[model samples]
Target chain A: MAGAGMKDRQSRMSRPKRLRKTLKIPAIFFALSLAGLIWALLVDGSSDGLAALAAGSPLMALLWALLYRRQ
Target chain B: MSANMIKRMAWVHKWTSLICTIFLLMLCLTGLPLIFHDEIDDALNPSHWVPAHPDGAMLELDRILEIALQHRPDDVPIFMSFDTDRPVVNVTTGARPDVAATAMHFASFDRTSGDLVPPPDNGAAIMDFLLQIHTDLFLGLPGMLFLGAMGLIFLAAILSGILLYAPFMRKLDFGTVRASRSPRLKWLDYHNLLGVMTAAWVLVVGGTGVINTLAIPIIDFWKHTELADLIEPHGAPPSPVALHSLDDAMAKAKAAVSDMVLQFVAFPGASFSTDHHYAIYFHGKTPLTRQMTIPALIDARDGRFAGLRPMPWYVKTLALSQPLHFGDYGGLPLKIIWAVLDLITIIVLGSGLYLWLGKGGQRMDPAMEPLWQGPE
Candidate 1:
């Protein structure tokens, strides 16, 4: 009975931890989208290297999130 | 969230998505080729003839106008535009100054030699076909307005989908596609995942597209209100007099705005200019400012500078929306990103269609159990 209780406790604890991990990728993507939009608005040349990085971040994040799911 | 609220949101999402999916799909497919329009044009019509004036000593604007007129004596000049990289001037002429665009004759002239440049076969017919279908479905203003309405519905669908996302994802982890489940559930996850990921891009592009569709009306309003007053002092438009030296007018316009380069000129009696003025439009050298134009109105009768007309906020917004919607401002890499995002959006749209159809016309409910709740 003690072993079953311990296992139940461990499973409950891991649920929130997995939820937090799942939240991380989306949070990063949200930040990247905001930054990219602002940079595109304020910067003079959006075609340059830095602007490309900023503008492409959302897609890149999506790619990373997809890959993370596969793992 | 409450189940009632989730149901309401799902209803909105379903209806809006269903209404706009076909039109949105058409836009994406046509937009894919438009993203690289310049490169495609260049590749198809390679410029073989070098500029006659290698030293960049361009001929007088008046002379070029005269040559253009000689080619089509019956036609009157409507607009004249300059080429940035080459010593060539493009002139548009028609039977009347206010002729419709379909009736206009366009030709290029060598700026230095006054010789007619051999026109390149740019696959114009195919490009026009794609552009017309993408822009207005060839229905003109009504088509544009209809598409604008569709764009609004698209925006509504995106917002409603976002609302449903919270409830749908409450029990599931983010980005979790249940590949082992039935195909419907698998596509549902993809639709949600890609939808949320591309939300910002869709919002901006979709919103800007709506703004762009209003361009003709906005320009008409500006002309009727602002430009009408500017030309009031000159009285009713008089009979067509021989226009003053375009070269002199161009020089004066250049003097007025030393930093800006001449982009185009609207001839007198054209929609863009007063009956007595040559509307010389100038644009800044930088990428951001290049999208905007400042008009320097010159009296065609006297070749004198009048004044620079200030653009209202709405007009400025329209100007800004052009580049933002095109995604060409950020160079090739940004364009590629736009294309990729565009393709992803297609998948999202396709998956949404599959889910709705795959359910055999049943009402979609957020609280519904997964299609494959047990082992497949």
Candidate 2:
């Protein structure tokens, strides 16, 4: 019974470790979204192709996140 | 951070958010429709009318003003603005030069043919209703100031929310919405996630919004302080008199800033001009610089060139903030991004309200509740 209790504690602790591993891709995508928005503002021309990338990347990231809910 | 500090911050986050949520929600919803206002207006009133003369030269500014005056003989022309894509000139006339915007009459005329352009029934009434409510709750400057105060509170709430995020997420991973948990906890997690994701945008928009609400005062200050020298040369305010040729004034203005294009002309005694000058405002040809205006003051009596005064930093900030807040500069796709973010804000506001209400029967976390609740 004591061994089982110790195992339960270890499992709880390991879940966060697992979460950290899964977080990498989504976290990078999220950072990309923020960077893209800032870049969009800094660009000189209006509605330029680069501006489109800056604006579209966040929505794409959002879609990706929604599709892969675990991340 | 200590638990006590987190508790104090949470207390602040709750009350500030609770106070401004409804107003912020209204702003977000109203603002969503406004984001596509140009597209909506175009769809409603398709521009089927063409320029009267496709090949002919545009009539002189003086001729356009004369034609506009003929339409409203009793009213004086307060402002004249040029359209970007067409040979149409928009003339704003009022009972007096200093008349308020609500009392002003606006009409468009073809500069080439000197003919009145048919006004489109563009659902302007509904749009104006929404705009007035969104701008000032129909209470003019006072309402604008009240909303500005609310914006400050909303900003405070956002800051406190961010501060609390670190503590709340200490035990959990980022974006971890526990759907299987109690509904309140689920929404709480969502609120945190969305809140953090949108923190930058909300800060920019909210901060800009607060600045926008102070527009009237800022312009007034500019007129009184920075523009005092310009107006001082004229001495006592001049009485109404026959104005000089607008075409000559525009020509002189063109000479001053040949690279830029004339955007608008504020006649004497107009809010944007001195009592004795025609403030000819010009904008750069480029996309970004077009948002920044350069005003050249022309003596209204003689159409002589007065000095061009560059706008101060604050005024420039106000101009830039207007577009950034609207997200209109980057075109349709940017508007879509703005709309999605706006919807997310609405959800955040709604879920926040839900969480607060759901806490009604449950025992309140003493740390989360305000100090006045006393050991609860």
Candidate 3:
């Protein structure tokens, strides 16, 4: 009876442990982003292609909509 | 999060991943072949041409240009690049003497003997086709923008996936994929576990690609802002300013940068150059990051070297993103690893779509009760 009760308590404790593990997702993402930023800073020349999207173009507006409309 | 917020996020995750999944799968598939393209190309049509002598004096640039121009008199050379590994030289020429023109040709030469190396028929044509399909899907700018939008959706899916992961894993371990459980549960677990492991790589490559797709606009912006003063009516006749000799212009460009090597030269009439300057593009000397360039523009009239302008932070970010996106940098081992990760991503995409569609179908079944009722 005591062992059964202990197992139940252990399972409950493990619930949030699982939740903490999920934190790795964002942690990994931010790490990659940081690495990219660092790599970008070290390079000498890059093509500046995105700055062409003016505010008036329908395509630009569409892209902005897709980017900003996060759930 | 509120119930509504959760619902909204779930919706976004479902739709975004669904829309881009197919194209992403195609890209991933085609890209796999491209990663080993050089090896594959060599394996099939082995090079037949050999140098006249290994220790012979290499041909001069002016001599090679004379020979190439002899064959095509009307065409003018736009760029020339030397290959380090092979004794080969490639010279690109165009009718209009500009990059914007489509009537351009590339001729290879045996550097030692200066003899024209005839290209093998259909060499790399299939690989080039696959690459173009992956890049623009034959749809041009609209195709690229459409893919960019998909990339943006891919980014959102990645974020929302991270959020949902927290809630789903609230009762599970980090790497526990319970294959003994129901198929749906097992796949869900696998998806979460694998997704977390590859999260960093996917985000970096995807984010950079999103920025890269914006290349057209960025170049336009650079022109509008930096080159705006030089913009003049297109019909202006050629100036009387004495054009600099190619050798002199190249030497001046070389003198501007101490350690790097010249990769190519954009002629004066090209878009990369103004009407009176040659844009000499130079790259680093190392394998770790040679694709990253440092360009110097030289005045053609006096061979005056314009100093190097470092790429802006954002633009530099885009450049570094290219290797990460293509997975061509590092080494062959890294390429293999990239291909494996790409396969894993396709699996994740497919599984996510299956889970969403399966759940939707289950909800429609009258026999099954709703998992979670919305707030009153």
Task: Please compute DockQ, using alpha carbons, for every candidate against the native two-chain complex.
Answer: 0.29, 0.20, 0.09
Query: What TM-score quantifies how close candidate 1 is to the native fold?
Result: 0.88
Tens digit of lDDT per residue, candidate 1, span B1-376? Answer: 4556666777899999999999999999998898888878888899898878788777888889998999998888899998888888999999988875668899999998988988775787777678888888988778889999999999999999876665454345567676666676777778888888788788878899999888778888888787876566686553343888888888888888878888999998887888889999998777667767888888988777888886788888999888778887777777887899899989989999998888887765443453213101
TM-score of each: 0.88, 0.88, 0.79
Relative to the unseen true structure, what is the C-alpha lDDT of residue B288 in candidate 2, on a scale of 0 to 100? Answer: 62
Q: Write the residue-wise lDDT of candidate 3 on B1-376 in tens digits.
A: 4456667777887778888888878877887888787677778768777787788887766677677777677777677777777778787887766543335788888877778887754556788778777777867667778778889989998888876665555444345555655667666766776665566567766887787777666655665566555445444524422456767777777888889977877766765556666778888875444767776877666677766655566556666777767766544545565666677788788787776667764533321111122221
| TM-score ranking, best first | 1, 2, 3
- B355: Cα error in model 3, Å: 2.0
Candidate 1: segments with Cα more than 4 A from true spot: A1-31, A41-47, B231-241, B361-376
Residue pairs of candidate 2 with colliding backbone atoms: none
What does the lDDT read for residue A64 in candidate 3?
46
Tens digits of per-residue lDDT for model 2, A8-47:
6544665446445434444564565556555655565553
Model 1 agreement with the true structure over A1-71: per-residue lDDT tens digits:
75367436544655446445545565576567656654664466533657767666777766765777531
Model 1, position B371, has a per-residue lDDT of 21
Q: TM-score (chain B) for model 1?
A: 0.92
Which candidate ranks first by DockQ, i.e. highest? 1
